[model samples]
Target chain A: MYFGPPGNTLVIVVSPPPDRPGLPARRVTIADIARAAGVSIAVVSYAVNGRPGVSAATRERVLRIAEEYRWQPSAAARSMHTGPRAVGLVVSTAAGGVSSASSFLDLVTAIQDVFGKHGYALLLKVVESVDAAVATYRTWWAERRFDVMIVTDVLSQDPRVEALRALRAPAVVVGAPAAAQGLTSVHLDDAEAFGRVASYLIGLGHRDVAVVTGQPELHRTQVRVAALARMLKDAGGSLLRMTTDAGPEEAAAATRQLLTSPVPPSVIVYDSDQMALAALDVARRLGVEVPWDLSILAASDSALCRLSTPALTALPSPLRELGTAVGDAVLAVLNGQSATSHVVPVGGLAIRGSTGPLARRTKQ
Target chain B: MYFGPPGNTLVIVVSPPPDRPGLPARRVTIADIARAAGVSIAVVSYAVNGRPGVSAATRERVLRIAEEYRWQPSAAARSMHTGPRAVGLVVSTAAGGVSSASSFLDLVTAIQDVFGKHGYALLLKVVESVDAAVATYRTWWAERRFDVMIVTDVLSQDPRVEALRALRAPAVVVGAPAAAQGLTSVHLDDAEAFGRVASYLIGLGHRDVAVVTGQPELHRTQVRVAALARMLKDAGGSLLRMTTDAGPEEAAAATRQLLTSPVPPSVIVYDSDQMALAALDVARRLGVEVPWDLSILAASDSALCRLSTPALTALPSPLRELGTAVGDAVLAVLNGQSATSHVVPVGGLAIRGSTGPLARRTKQ
Candidate 1:
């Protein structure tokens, strides 16, 4: 496969068709080209607009017929052939919502670095919901404003996948393969990461474990929950699950509720490093000694985890590598490759001062 | 001041001039219109492209002459008139660099929310340096890819401002007015905020103070340092300044160096909450008691500051309000209005557990 040299100019050549006697009376439309090429209008559109889905031969035939018929594209369609290269990424969240996960920004930076090297700008739109994101994508697609799209936070049975499929837009999803619904995806092995967590906790002779995770609806959250639950059960241990909005206060509230419960677990695991830090604050306030009366673990690691009072034992997700993988997938899709999924490796659990043997939990 | 209704469609009308005897022998170009209108090619180009820096009357005249000559715009110029409305924001930072200040993401979200309401998309590009950022802006300007640009992290003598001015690109700087170099700016009252910090610390009976700040070249950092240093001198107290790359390790190292020095200040202030948190970790390892043996403060506030072991006292910059102000400035520039700077209100210092009266300190 040829990866063209990075540059500002984009060259798409369309040779003139066999000589015709005269120009048509009326202007040639996409419908005329579709009929002449013996293909559906969508196929003609995909070919004419330089979008993915149609084969190279089909695109060439459609273009030749379009040239022969003297078809003129609207300004919006014309811009697609002349505009600066760009990729659209619509983030569905409330204002300031993205700040909660610095990892999101890291991922964006990584992706931008890759696309920038390939001479493509990232067009970002922050909307309020998945429906709005889908609508934004539809509008951008209709305008032919960008060459490709990057879809993140893929949901179970996401509508975006189907929407992009129908539009024949080239896109890459940054989530699990199952959630991607056959689209190209770059994701971490959440199940494998969580399995390592369970083994480490079970090795500490802890039979009872509790998990504090973000929104339960997230496919990532579900995957980790399933993996940890399965592993704990296999070890003859029990698992308790609690969910938060991924905010520090919510995480603290969940931690408080767990510690005061009639039967609190021997260890508590948090989905994010920030959430785990909040739990540490809550534990300190409740006069619970870490790794002595209780244990704490963060599923995601960051500088915060390394510097916290009792440095948190965490499963480090390779966010930069994951981002690079996502960027590569985007480039592949844009280059007309078939949809493929990539699973980047996750690092081993970093054992710190946060976790200890269940025998130390005398109060429990 | 007509603030057009928010929508995707952009209409630029150029009506045909009074009947000309006959069409020109050759295609008319911007140069032909410029010659006919008795203006420089730049002026005519600006007028024809609907960009700023051209008077309304001159633009009208240029448009009429161009229509009279039957001049047609290139594909790029035509796209400027019909493409979806967008604003560009190029962040000059290394990959994963933006993750350090979650506040940056908050600002982006806030800005995106306002622009989204106005039917504009935010096109983001993250580059490695200011020079690259300016080059990106120049390319985008030539392509007419965006309606306005949002500039951030203004330096004492920024080349970006000069470049944008030369291109006559409508832009808004998110920094001090002095640093904006005649461009519209949205900024916090850094002097006022720093003055408040100075007074609060001095009122607590602290004599000597040390500040751990990010890159000193940043306009924001310079303003803060000058304000704090001047105020400290006026109050008969000495000030020590330390700079960092805004990384947690650097902040920690700075804190350790200060603590192990021959003479440590009674109080320490940090440029960011993350740095302040790192300082707390350093203080803990050094056996220095916060608010007792030493006082700590953060210039920017966040949930981490509120939830730290010894909750940090911080000056909360109204990032959301600042972002809204920036959005408004961008819209004003797009609507053919003159450039103007805006200063959003900053909240007063929030006194928390980390700071206390200097009388409580005895180690010195």
Candidate 2:
């Protein structure tokens, strides 16, 4: 190949044929013409690509230069003309390296199942701290790696929601959009879950009750606690205790303190089924009989909860369903369609041997 | 821009263009050169790209074409010339969307932590059925989306190991790779965990013992059961009863049946801290006294286990550390470095008040 100043450009004899016999391939690109014409690159782009702003004479000149070079972009380049096909999912988990709730895990599976069916593969990146979560959103937006992002375990006034808005990026939150204003959100009716459990305990004739929950700072926990308090007040009874655990150990310690209190409630309610089991152990250690001396209720029930001694009275909450619903809402928002805040109803209360009419009190 | 037969090649004229700029736009691509080169596109690609076999003169001609067009692929494409930077983790859970063990969850978090620190993001995809798991792996491979893959909760003679081999993708598994043949793997010393628990119980003067575990098919469970069998045999007493729970309900039901048997074991060793609580509950319901009729041993201790009634006896297992170690191994393997299979030692047995010397029997 040979090149020189424009009009007198010389074409030299090339060597060595491709190994493949009888196959002639032709793929050209605009860059070739720009070099041949000694013109600015964008002028070449405007001339051959037919994009606007270049004069017809200039466009014609650029095409003539490109023709002399016989340049074309490869098939791969032609395909690039189409829109980006890959969809991106930015999975944000709560900080502290905590695994998401069981229900959220299930929901993730369901959402993945649905997305996979639609030929979209989910891409996950764990967002450790709130700051890191914000950074991830910013990075993903600037790079445009994903078509949509799903933020999960949203907090009241999640900073990420604002980050997404600032970038004008599409996002769906998997918890109440407490501070997200117009962002799409999905979550379970925690108040209802709380009200049901409180009502069930009251129906069983338990006036004194205790509630143990996870981190009080979690929005859902606050909602449930408030609901429990309101229900107890309306029922002409008062909650004996409300404690929270950052994790299982804290839950167990709370159980011990609550159970051994001078005036322990006859029944205990746990925010998570796992914590409820801890409470059961505390009761057993104290020689307190379940359903006989102390009844137990689980706001969130699972196989583990149901199988606890005396079979706990529980709220039938489906976590997997909630996760999938959030995922669906995210997809809708990303697709430029407005989606309503999704509220998955918790299942009705599950009554088991864990609850019995208050043991008849004997006159002292 | 204009194009014609070889000699009447394309030309691009930059009119009022070189100095005019707003935000200095990116360059155009080879496709623009093709349109200018006039010959059925391939001619331009054949000429300017100089990809060989284009006659010398034709190659020179194509170069002239590109020079006229002035196009180039995006900088993003240039950076991607090496490959994608992320790794994919396909977490396989048990049937019914159940997550892997808590230890595994910790490991995942740890792995993510380490990987993120090293400038690589971990991509998590949860697969339920084994078939779906394999399919997801194949899809990811076909797309070349991940640099390396991590498969967890390895089954006995898992098909994924073999499938991964066929794919020849770099991967680090979280179980014994011996069965996996050529694939690299990291394994936990299950036998050690069980041995520690068994020895703890034997030291407590308990000859009769029961074990509760998860699905028997799990490789770790089998290892624990085998270790328990061998150790118990040495003590002149073999395992009295060993049961598995597909979930918590089955575990509780099994515990109920075990305790209600004609002769219940004096001590129960639980596979998980969660299951141990269930065993404790069974003892309480049967009116059995701890340390007197029942001594409980929690095999895997978490913070939750320590806070259980009697502050349960448990094996000090560090899941987060193991997870981080595995994650490092994955990154190493992906980076073309050799990673040895590491077996992190389990922490020593933490004996709490849950177990005590066996009750002395008086002659009738």
Candidate 3:
């Protein structure tokens, strides 16, 4: 196979013919890649063949360029990626509480639908902490555990972005990391969604509202809290906030504390359906009628929302669509495409039985 | 490595002394396995070294024998097992709907807790159908996709048990597959628990009872149905049963159908807390007072049980403990030990507001 940069033109013998019949048509040629990437044929040949004459950065750019043009490596080159046909979803234990959240399940199903068709099995890992999650990613990369990974619960200033990029790992971040830093990302617009939900509540004559958020450190929670604060400020409503581990007991205890205060808020907003349900339980226990004495709203949509007594009003997320977008990003990254970002928009608030105007009407 | 058998003595020169220091202690010799298996040293050596003369069946038997006695392979041999550090949990799409069930979340946490500590990521797959699930297992085995797998929603005649067993895949069944057929299993006793719950309800002076089950095709459902039938017969009461997809809409419709019947059940047993909550909603909408006009029981336990307006009575499955047992079983299987089973016992029922003494004093 002869490859060279002749003057300003890159020259190459596209396929060195000792084809021994019909074994090379499926393979993308170096000349084809070089033309697509607009680089010298020689550089494309080196990148394709795993020769280190070119810089790693240049090689990566060339590979992404090749993938962008939908190039398929030949039998010889495909061998380099012939380990297990698996992708992974790695989560932190802190995010485990959301496992029962219906949106997560819907997203998981959607992701499996796309990846399964492409023959990539989903490997899910829930690590004890963010550090453990990072370590797991590094170990998996070193051991070639998966062809690609989907990182959930991304942090505001994610260290994983640079860490994974340094290794050129193929991964898609769910819930946009604050500083994406070249990592492929697929996430919902949490700030916009939270503002929208808050506005809906504020429009309902709710003031002196209490926001029950999940853990303070979670990137999504912090983002939502900030968005809520801004929206509430605009509506001239003051806010009381409580942060919890998002467990049933903790959420209930927090709800209890909020309701039993000297001057309790009339409306309570929750980060999870479970927390809102806990609030509902608190209402029943304390003789506070839902939507009458206290109105409730869920920041996240879930089956729990619909099943509750006065089904919760929630910000409906198009989770399945987001999952498909994540799947696409993951597949693109796995195919060596340049990292990209996607913003999956949320649906408008689902108005259920849990929310109403604060005006009291006399019983007929 | 020469190995020989004499009468009762199996002599094995397990490692040809390339100690280079303190490495031998970490490596178990072929002789150590031969004596433990009570087999000839030559067979042990053949099994350990992957010699072609030994049969595949014989090799598997020898490997299990080696693991039985705690034979740790050396770094040289361990390299063969150095691929993905991952496990998998394969569930059906029908079961995927149950992802919101608090019990499922608990099990997921437990599985991650166990597997994460040992560095095995959980690969979760929700397939389109039973056939797809089987295909996934076969493909995973062909591609060596996982180090271990936990098969949930085991069926009456589970094809996966035999198929995976044929490949000698390391898997632990969440519920006992009717035909375990050499596969490792860990399950809760569905029938016994159902009988106990039935007895409790019968003791509460209920005669006309309704038992709502999840997908009736599931083995656990069949077992529980059979048990409930027996217990109800023993108590001289007939049952009004309904099997739905266990969704909120379907469950609510079913509850409405049962409640509005000419002879409505005095007590209702639900397969899940969500269904029971839906039943609760139906009761409220119909103006039937709980505990006075009807009683409810949730066969599956979850936080939903506690958070409902009238908290549900439920059977608690210690999911974390079960997960630990599964992890231990997976570790055991990966270590090539003889296949084993563990029965995770359920705790006494969590009695709550949803259930109460049937009012024969008023209704009759």
Q: Model 2: what TM-score? A: 0.73
Candidate 3's residue-wise lDDT over B1-364, tens digit each? 3233333333233433453221123234566676555566788767777987766655676787565444544322333446455677777766434533445555676777766777667778876677777777766644445678788877677776666665456788877646466688888887778889889989998889988877776777788888888899988998877988877667888989998998899998887777787788888888888877899888777776787768889998677888888888887877778778888887789989888988733464
Which is superior by lDDT, 1 or 3? 1
Candidates' chain A TM-scores: 0.76, 0.72, 0.73
Which candidate model has the greater TM-score, 1 or 2?
A: 1
Q: In candidate 3, which residue ranges exceed 4 Å CA deviation?
A: A1-84, A96-103, A165-168, A177-179, A360-364, B1-86, B95-102, B112-120, B165-170, B177-182, B360-362
DockQ of 1: 0.14
When just chain B is superposed on the true chain B, each candidate scores a TM-score of 0.76, 0.74, 0.74
- What lDDT score is found at residue A114 in candidate 2? 56
lDDT of 1 by residue, A14-85 (tens): 232243233333234566666666677788778877888877777777787777665645434546455546
Q: Can you rank all candidates by TM-score, best first?
A: 1, 3, 2
> Candidate 3's C-alpha lDDT?
0.72
- Residue by residue across A1-364, what tens digits does model 3's lDDT show? 2233323333233443363221223234456677655577888778867997876666776777665444544322332346446686766756543633445566787887887788777777655677777776766665555678787767676666666665556778886646566688888888898888778878888877888887776677788888888888888888888988786767888889988898788788887777787788888889888888888998777765886778999987677888899888877887879878899888788999999987533222
lDDT of 2 at B166: 60
Q: Which stretches of candidate 2 lie over 4 Å from their true place?
A: A1-104, A177-179, A201-210, A233-243, A255-268, A284-295, A353-364, B1-79, B95-104, B202-210, B240-246, B257-266, B357-364
Which candidate number would show the highest lDDT if scored against the true structure? 1
Better of 1 and 2 by lDDT: 1
Question: Higher-DockQ candidate among 1 and 3?
Answer: 1
